[model samples]
Target: MEFEMIIMNLLNYSGEARSYSMEAIQFAKDGEVEKAKKSIEEAEQKISLAHKFQTSLIHSEAQGEKLSISLLLIHAEDHLMNAITIKDMATEFVDLYVRMSKISNGGC
Candidate 1:
């Protein structure tokens, strides 16, 4: 498989994960806890796919062959970092919904 393809795939996976995470927060805000949880699960799965690709790169580097970097790889890394950050924040937001649900009795 070409490195460019790998990188593009990584970016797609990362973006998908980030989108799902955001959706989870939206669902929670809309008072859909179950849907929120499902979103999180989907996000987790997406992240796992990204992680697998990341591990592949790391493993290749650790084995003493540096993977040649390209603009696509950089773009993918950017997406992966942003996605992870957004996902973390989304998780916190979702947790807050749990507390809010307690106070509002899931009315909102």
Candidate 2:
């Protein structure tokens, strides 16, 4: 695969992950726990795909393949990092919402 295409794939997957994570949090806020969980699972799968692309780039660099640091590559990395951060926060938010629901229902 071309380097630029790999980066674009990573960006696409990361963007999907970010979007799913956001949707998961919104679902949680709306008290749709199952939908939120499903969204999180989908987001995780996308993140895994993105991570595979990232690992390939790292392996290529380790094999002495010199990759040009292009603006698009940097933007792709930003998307990946942002997606990771948002996923983490979304997970926490979902958990908090779940707990709040439980408390409100007198479960705990």
* Per-model TM-score on C-alpha atoms: 0.89, 0.97
Please give, for residues 48-106, the per-residue lDDT of candidate 2 as tens digits.
99999999999999999999999999999999999999999999999999999999999
Clashing residue pairs for model 1? none
Considering summed lDDT, which 10 consecutive residues are worst modelled in model 2? 1-10
Query: Clashes in model 2: which pairs?
Result: none
Error of model 2, residue 87, in angstroms:
0.5
lDDT by residue for model 1 (1-108), tens: 566777877998999999999999999999898898898888888988998888888888899987888778888999998888888888899889888888777555
List runs of model 2 lying over 4 Å from the truth.
Answer: none
For each candidate in turn, give its C-alpha RMSD to the true structure in angstroms: 2.4, 0.7
What is the lDDT, from 0 to 100, of the residue 92 in candidate 2? Answer: 94
